[model samples]
Target: MIERLQLLVAERERVLGHFLESEQREIALACHSIARAFSRGGTLVAYGVDSAETDAAHVAVEFMHPVIVGKRALPALAPPNDVRGVLRSGDIAVSIAHGAEPAPVRAFREQARHRGALTIALTGGDRVDSDHAFAVPSEDPQVVQEVQETLYHVFWELVHVFFEHPGLLDDACITCGDVAIQARVVAVRNGNAVIEKDGLREEVAVELVAPVDVGDMLLCHAGVALERVE
Candidate 1:
């Protein structure tokens, strides 16, 4: 068991090593896409189909989380949770799927693209060629799940750089106006938890509506919070 565990850790490191090796280029590509979308006044949308839902949420949280660079108070809209909600085109979508496009993601992308969003597809190693695929090139049967999860994070980390160092947009949002808004938490908070936004890390104000914790992606605006990012 110990040997297997060690092997797994090594393999995981190799995957990350590849990521680090290409960080500069990957960040360039990802930031370029993000800036292009933002230049057109686009929203960032994230979602996953079936089991990939968790990855979708992770992508959104990483972007919206405090101190994570492009950490906007902007609420990430997931179409499956609210079918009637709008996801217009020009929005950026970080989608995940192992082999094929999931139904929920397909539906959401359809709506988003029709509205004019640019899609960034993050697929598993098993997936066929995807122009938008952020390839990790791993085939560890014991760590398929880990690879899928990593794929989600690797892209978003690049997304963060896109907002901070801004290789592509060149800090376009520096002068952009803010959309003043507010929200309230719908649940509760236990232990040490806080709300993060706009590089301003503030402790979650309300408990009932501020049900978030470490690693959770929350939607915050004007002291009102809602829709945990998972």
Candidate 2:
């Protein structure tokens, strides 16, 4: 009995190590994509089969209510049973499947693709057909699920990094000042203004006292353009 338990622990560790080494780059790229989707007002939709159902729900709730204070809440949902008609264009569809990839999950991924949504598959199968696929590379179902929970948590954390450092993602090259940040107005659309600070640019909600135009300089705060700067 003792020998069997020792072997199980060793096997689990080996599988987790292999997964982390092999999937690191793919995981980074997926997190970047998820962050971009959220910035564009996209939602995360997760689905799973059998024991994975609870994981799907957990992922949704974590995004909707982050434990870390000051982190912005992002939208997420896990549909019970069928995921059909719930996904839309610009949304993200995450399918979590253990052992063989389930038929319904595969079909849902395909449908999401047709609707212009990003598809991510976490599975213990040969491979999942999607924009991004992470094969856990574990024969043991429990090991696969355990690694998957860690993977999704990592995803959630990394996605927030992009939000926190918008300047890094947007390649903004500007110095900050007391009270407000200086930016060049790049475009004005639908009552919001896209501003370039240094070289980086992002859309900011604005209620201009006077009309503003592209190439104007403005002061921004908390993603809102407060006033034009000389």
Candidate 3:
């Protein structure tokens, strides 16, 4: 019994270490994106099929009723029906699955993406069509679920870091005249551009200029770039 327990503990630790090391950057970026979504008054919609339903519910509750005191509650829910029914643009869509995501979950995630929601997939190391995907290193269903649970809890904790800094998120109400602001594109990802102006960085929609690249200067207004500055 002691040997069996020790082996299980060791495997869990090994898998967790690998998961964290491989997914640290992805995890950070996902948290920031979730924070930005909340800043834009977007809700988080968590969903899954079968046993994964438990994880979806856990994520919703954690965001809607934070465990840490003084942290503001964020809008989140695990819809009992199709996630697409509640998904909206700028919202965050999260799906939990083990190895081989069910067809329905994949379909729902795709639908959410089509509707302009930020998609997050917690799966067992499968390539998913999402803005951010974090996979546990182990294929063991129990291990995968446990690590994903930890990931979401970490997400809940780290997302607050961005909220503490107001400048990191876009301010929708800050607009004056028809004039636009010129900013240098620092980074671009998933239809959004991270632009820097006088050392202040902000994300703006770059869909109008689909081919935006780093170091490109753009004319931005109302949280979206109108065109490139030549």
Candidate 4:
């Protein structure tokens, strides 16, 4: 029994590690989009099929009532039936499926897309159609669900990163006096750079600090790079 437990633990680690490595960038992007939606006063509507129903409720609670001290609550919900009538533009739709893709989940995501809402699909099978689909690279339903649980938790925790930089949000146009956060550059595109700090990611204008590359640290304020930190 002890040996079997160890094997199971090792397998879980392998599956989780591989997923993080492959989906790290995508996860960050999804978090960024989620934060944007929340900042714009949009709600998160989640639904799950089969065993994932519990996951939908868990994610909703985590976002609506944050566990971390000082973290503000965000709008999230898990509706019992079809959310097509509930979703609106700028809202977020999350569809969770453990192993098989059901018709309702598919229609939920499709309607979300058509309504201009951000769609995220978490499933164990490939070929999901959504703006951000994370398919766990595992055949076992239990392992896939576990990994997806971790994924949504990560979303709940890191979505607050964008909140820290209010100036980075389009809906927030406030002056942050003498406040500059340090972040490491992860990706550079045109005049903007994607930065990460403590698992929170944001893209700020780096035109002022031209020629900055990935792995460089910079001090940012009001959605713009102040200077490169040596």
Cα TM-score of candidate 2: 0.72
The whole-model C-alpha lDDT of candidate 4 against the native structure comes to: 0.83
Please report the TM-score between candidate 3 and the true structure: 0.77
| Candidate 2 residue pairs in clash (backbone atoms < 3 Å) | 172-200
Q: Which candidate leads the pack in TM-score?
A: 3
Question: On residues 87-157, what C-alpha lDDT tens digit does candidate 1 reach at each position?
Answer: 66557766666545666666665565444455566554533221134544565433545665765555555
Q: Give candidate 4 regions above 4 Å deviation.
A: 171-230
Estimated TM-score for each candidate:
0.56, 0.72, 0.77, 0.73
User: Tens digits of per-residue lDDT for model 4 on 51-96?
Assistant: 8888999999999998888998989989987778999988999999
Query: Which ten contiguous residues of candidate 1 have the minimum total lDDT?
Result: 183-192
Model 3 lowest lDDT segment of ten: 168-177
Which ranges of candidate 1 are over 4 A from the true structure? 19-27, 68-71, 81-85, 103-111, 126-131, 139-145, 148-157, 164-230
RMSD of 3: 5.3
lDDT of 3 by residue, 1-230 (tens): 99999999999888988888888977887898899899998999998888899889999999999788999899998987777888888899998897668888898888887777888998986757567777776679888888888899999998998899878776533223378888888655557876766545567888898788877999888788899999
- The candidate, 1 or 3, that scores higher on lDDT is 3
Cα error, candidate 4, residue 100 (Å): 2.8
lDDT of 2 by residue, 143-195 (tens): 99998999999999999997887754543324333567888875555456667
